[model samples]
Target: MNYFELHIGDYAEATQHLSILEDGVYSRLLRKYYASEKPLPADVAIVQRLIVAKSKEERAAVEAVLQEFFVLAEDGWHQLRCDGEIERYRSGEPERKAKKANEEERMKRHREERAELFTKLTAAGAHAPWNLPIKELRERVAALPAIVSGDEPATPATGPETLQVGEPATAPATPATATQTPIPNTHYPDTNTQTPTNIGINTPLPPKGGRKRSREPVEEPQGFVRFWAAWPASKRKESRGKCAEVWVREGFEALADVIVAHVEAKRDQTDWAHDGGQYVEAPMVYLNSRKWEGAEVGAMHQRKREVVI
Candidate 1:
């Protein structure tokens, strides 16, 4: 199952041991003779020539000479094996098993450390009050003044009147001035104006239709909204590790998208109006670490929230 076993024991020695040794010897002898000031023996001269020779036949002849040494030297042959099988076994099953066990223990320790840290963190910081109802959370958030409202109270402006006689007299009229004729409600002939001759004081106004209704104001609940942007709840939970800092930005994106889309499509306007305010806490966005922020919400680009707050 291991590399050495697959290649048969002492595979390197059986296959290329002689050549490998010769290459080493040849290289060393060449370095000592050619690179250094030392002069090689005349017989050793043959090695340098054979190594430099370009022909394959010449290289084979040189290798044959090296093999002769390997055959005669029992110590040399044993040296080539050199605890090969034992070394391979030591590197195999037992070592690998030990290493794997050590790795698992390391991972287990790391997990325990994280869990302990989380326990400490949960103890230190606030826990979302257990099993809080959605209705209650909403109510609490609703009580907050910062929550956006659906409609703003309209403030009437003082502007010019269209020739209506509704101004209070700035100065008292002179008592002896010529009697002024009272102005009557005159009828404009054209347009959608219907002149009513029966202009009695207590005439009820026409049924209150045919006018464009004003848009409702936006309202926000009292508290900040919690939106989970992450796909799985586990990711959200994990990010809250110990003194968890990072929450997924995806959750906030989801909340913002939903709220924005709802508003843009004008859906649930009545419900929103009933709900007190129109604002929803955008999805939970843990930007980098340590803090969660709300996503930017608006009509057109709300759907494309990858990471905006």
Candidate 2:
């Protein structure tokens, strides 16, 4: 086990009678026990080396702590409380892993279900719900049952109209034309007519005509779309708009490769994969937090090699 629970009250009660130095030594020994995931060495010299006890006072403290808290068992020197914690951790590990796996499987199924629904909606000619205004999307969804059932047509009739089956068609009579009356014409002067008086005033010629500066719509880049697709979905999925805004504002398009690489490298990390990925940040949150910007690619690789060595 890499970790063990240390209840403050229990710890204090156990070490209450020990001196401060003895308490420190006891704490160090407990850390070694958990870190090594085994019993401590029975030899005092080896134990001193493990706890880094050098000075005479420190050695004395170590001996006193061991006498008070540890037992010389058949295997080695063991702390009963530490042994109990280790037992609990070992016993619970399999159950914890099983639960995590089940949760991950459940989440995977949920994502597949959503993807299927999105495909169906798109095939039905409904605009992508993610791209539609929330109210409009809700209305479409509310009306989807009727549309799918064929009970209601896509377009409703405006008014009732019918054709008679047995009646013969009748021709309508034309109306008489009215006589025309002529009237005098009224003409208006053109606004651009020349002025009678010549004025010697210098006027700035109108700025040379040029093409209008029209701003084309900001299209979502393919890289961002790919990145979004690769990102694990979570409750913060709705924050995609905010994420896109940040991506544009920060000009993250050029760094898309870097972001993707960072995500790939960190995806399987304990922090990201823990709790069935519940700890993974939303795409927008991860980007806005600048997590991808600080990826230590070569450094991580070097550390991995060192660990293996």
Model 1, residue 195: distance off in Å is: 47
Error of 1 at 12 (Å): 20
lDDT of 2 by residue, 1-309 (tens): 656677888888877988888888988998899888789998888899888999999998888888888999877899888888788878998998998799768656644443344444444555342223334444554566666536678686743234367756655666555653333222222224323322113422223452232333456775577678767655656666667778888867655545655676677654775666777777877887878534433332233222110
Clashes by residue pair, model 2: none
lDDT per residue as tens, model 1, 189-228: 2223434653334444444443332333323221112222
lDDT of 2 at 97: 97
lDDT of 1 at 67: 51
> What is the C-alpha local distance difference test score of each model?
0.36, 0.65
Q: Give candidate 2 regions above 4 Å deviation.
A: 125-309
Instruction: Candidate 1: give its CA RMSD in angstroms.
Output: 26.3
